[model samples]
Target: MYERQNQRHVPGHTFSTPELAWAWLRSEQTLIDRGEWTPPATRRQEQEAQAQREAETSTPFGAYARDWIANRTTPRGTPLAPRTVSEYHSYLEGPLADFAGRQLADVSRADVKAWWQRFADKPRYRHHAYAFAKSVYKAAVKDGLLDANPWDIDNAARVVLQTPKTVRATMINDLTPEDVQRVADATQPEQWQALVLLLAWTGLRPGEAFGLQRRDIKTSYIDGIPCWRIHVARAVSRSRTPDGIRVDTIGTPKTPESIRHVWLPPHLVPAMEDHLDRFSQPRAEGLIFPSTNEALPFATTQQVAGTTGKQRRDRTGGKVRPPSGFNGARESIGMPGLRLYDLRHWARRILLSAGMGELAVEQYMGHRLPAVQGAYAVLDPRQVWPVMLRCSDLAGWTPSAAAPAGRDTAVLLNEMTAEQLAAAVSAMSPDQLAVLVPTLSPEALVRLLGTQGRP
Candidate 1:
């Protein structure tokens, strides 16, 4: 009970949101309306009986592993992703076979830890081995086969190969405004121009950028100025077949937090418009970067000859190698070793330079953190568009507010976000907020109003 509380793990009764809580209550209400639902009298007895039955017929780890994985389900109640299932099978067969023939109930924390120590040198699969052990033992507890999980040992998670120095070079030396224009000028086939802008300008992951569709782009008002709101809900993934063809899977983003909206600068709209006018399909549902022949919208294939080409060395010695549009663009800009990911790294710096907060940056980057942080602040385009546009403001590319306000500074200030306004108001305290008559975010301003009534 203490362990469960420490992990913040709760049984399926109440959920995080009012909507989910209501749904749960409604479900019980429906069951009660059916006349067959009632509170159980012998809950402990029933649990004890089930446990006794499980103990009577001891199951081996190999067989139990199969059953455990087969029953595993995702958050939305869908079956686990194919890639996830495949990895689980691989771990069971390779690093976790020591307990295969042993009784599932008899497996100890010591055995799981010893197996983890043996595989910790690989670095990549170090955490995976520990995770699999925790999962199997956790499943056993849930299935009434064990009172507690044997694989919750903390020492099992420490990987010997991990080091702070192994990280990539610091992203401090970021791309500049002039550097961006040069790269944009060099992109060929014309369509790649917007692709270049989307990557460098927006902090979207490569897969997220590649998976963008025409319909995902929408326009909305931010601080009374119209801006583009790019809906980022999905990403592209690839898998290689036995016959050697690479297939693309259009799935949900890497995590739930990754499903977010990004605000592109108003000046950048024309570039998107120009790219869509020429490259994107006529229909709204078409991919922005479809294959040349237009058969596969989110994918293209590479031949075996190209895969084993003597002209170059492989990035990962694997399949599904797509031609890079940025590699050629790099030489045109006179900058080499500037990777596609560098653009995203530089974007964070640009936002920070523009006075955007770390929380705002993390939200825009779609970084996964604890669930509580998301509840207080759900950043809409109105809150994040202006922050992102500040970098473009550096280029003197004023398209929206260029005419509305005489000075560019006034235009940008007028475009200050609801969150920014809220934060500013909150920092000013009661005396300052009293003098400021501007209409602010009601959620934040209500507290100020209440404080104004106080001494």
Candidate 2:
């Protein structure tokens, strides 16, 4: 029965099923407020409630990933860089998309493991998947959506997904002089040859030589010896090129250690000076090697010259011009694979092998000492001359080669003993010596030990 509350003219209602009336009175406010008793639609209500829960639980993984992507779009996206973001997007759209849907909570470890197994065949993709998953999981964990990151489950650090083979420093060290020569020779262009020489001889990166300016070369006295001062400030390489621009650009050196002023070898000094005189524009900031039409001198000018000022006829017109100087000379000589930068590496090795002090070597290379302030204190260049001389002596150039002359051979050989020589030979492993020592003449060995010896 139902009766209206506060009714002057009262109206009453009676239910057919008493159980329904009791159920409605207990659960449904609509009937209870009217003083009526009617049961709720329990079966329909229960089914609808269950459906709502399933909808919440069954949220697609892709949807969550989209949410994550939108959240990171502003903050992380800026720093990710366009190229890096493009790569991440590629992984997401291709590989990761495979597991994007299905509630994250419902994702099993076996499912994750299976995905990894497929990626194992594609090492780069596997690496990208792992990295992307870890990043996403970290964000999820931070948001309190996930209690634990699934990416943290395995030893991701130990995993080595196959990718392109890395070029090793050890391999560079292993390269013999002949190997250097071969690489240099194969490069037909003069610029490549010069670049190789600079890298091998001075250990100057390909870009560093490109960044060199006319004024960077100063005719200065080093160790009381006339030399050229190579002030390293900039680097020019393809890395700095704009997306659409084929012209290479210049930028600051790769590291603080890279910005240095090195004293040129006396023999090389004349050639370097000659090179400057011949090729360098006298303008203060004139690139040591400037492009013919490149407008932005901040980057891209080096041994390679290209006409990219919309003036060149070549379809691919914006390439660095071939190298010049000794590289050109080498090309003329029918030598294969000679590089300009190789001279720098060769020089470093010579100085090191000649027993130059660490500080002196650091100074020679324009490298900073951690203990001292890196700015403005002039030191005597003469103090470094003796070691420099020793380096020149060790290089031992013929009339045809460019190297400084020094103290007589007999004087150098008067310094080592047989025992010391033998001990040195024994203590240094054959492999180590084979790897590091370029050549060991008997006289040089004696000189190195500071005793007269037959070795």
Candidate 3:
């Protein structure tokens, strides 16, 4: 029988979580007091009997791998994005199949080495094979089918290549003031324009933008300072089901820090104020940018009312207008070339180059960290004027030079009305919209309305 506790117990061998360790220790002590336990059987006959039963009843590696993947699903209950278990099944069904019938013990170091050799032969398959095998072993270990993982041995050749003479430009395109105006001007769609403007100014990710709502913005003053805050609540993702049907969904922001509040520039503040008037919906449907259905924000390659016209005409037996509009917007605007995410990259580059501290930008961008010490405290838009002015200069945007110095600041707001702005947004092509939308702040939208001067 085992003693109450080992006389020479290692100092650090206890569990990391006290609750777990204490419970395990209590059970072990009870067993010792009653003399009812002994060390587990390690005999050859015992091993053989266990092996015989497992071989007779244990699931095949391919089958087990699939079931294990299904049971260990994440909150989304889907396999890891960018990968799948069916692919794992293929590997086991092929080269790894021989070991499927053999007991887990029969698999040895030599067998693992041989499989690695075969896996390494195909460069494209090599990474996947290595990852798949590791996952298989891990699952088997959890199920008590293996004593220890032999695949942990690091015995593989490394691949290497030289850096290029000149690195291609990263996502940071080093945009000029004229470049920003040209892109904005070239963009004809209002929603796309707003989306682009948000990226050019605030650095919000495409998915985050897609998930935005009118309520998330808190435009209020603390003490005497004017501040503009954006509270990130959620993001959009796309997935395909087992039947090959595609679905789009929204979930909470990727990380805790991603749920952040960003300060706006005072100049941009007017633009945002005007932007609210322009895009603010009376109902929840008043998303800054809604999917064609007007129920959710935008997603790519989605078929929106692709056959609504035909279906409508068939049902009415006459020329009937469709319930939803045509499905050609995303492709019509040249959005395929400039991914939705490029706006975010462009925003970071603009802010970082204009002298915003790394921590401030990171905080504004919602990057998660272990601690909050390195982050900037939330502040008002007026506090960010220097950075914002530099940003406007970088983007080639200039507020009206003719507004009198003493007039109400609102008089010089963008020259566009909310209705005209909405019309502008509704008329632009997707690509044009992408570039134009990101530039639309409350102040910018008002200025665009021809409200450039006072009475």
- Among these predictions, the greatest TM-score belongs to 1
Question: What are the per-residue Cα lDDT tens digits for candidate 1 across 86-198?
Answer: 66766766677777778877777777667656765675685886687688777777766688787876755665543232232342254577778777766655666676677
| TM-score of candidate 2 to 2 decimals | 0.47
- Winning candidate number (lDDT): 1
**Residue-level lDDT for 385 in candidate 2:** 41
Q: lDDT per model, in order?
A: 0.62, 0.52, 0.54
Worst 10 residues of 1 by lDDT: 301-310
- Candidate 2 on 353-388: residue-level lDDT in tens? 655545556656656566554453443444334344
lDDT of residue 66 for candidate 2: 56
lDDT of 3 by residue, 287-359 (tens): 5556644453454423221332233564565776432212222234333233345556667777776656566
Q: On a 0 to 100 scale, what is the lDDT of residue 64 in model 3?
A: 63
Tell me which of candidates 1 and 2 scores higher on lDDT: 1
- TM-score against truth, every candidate: 0.58, 0.47, 0.52
lDDT of 3 at 128: 61
Residue 147 lDDT (model 3): 72
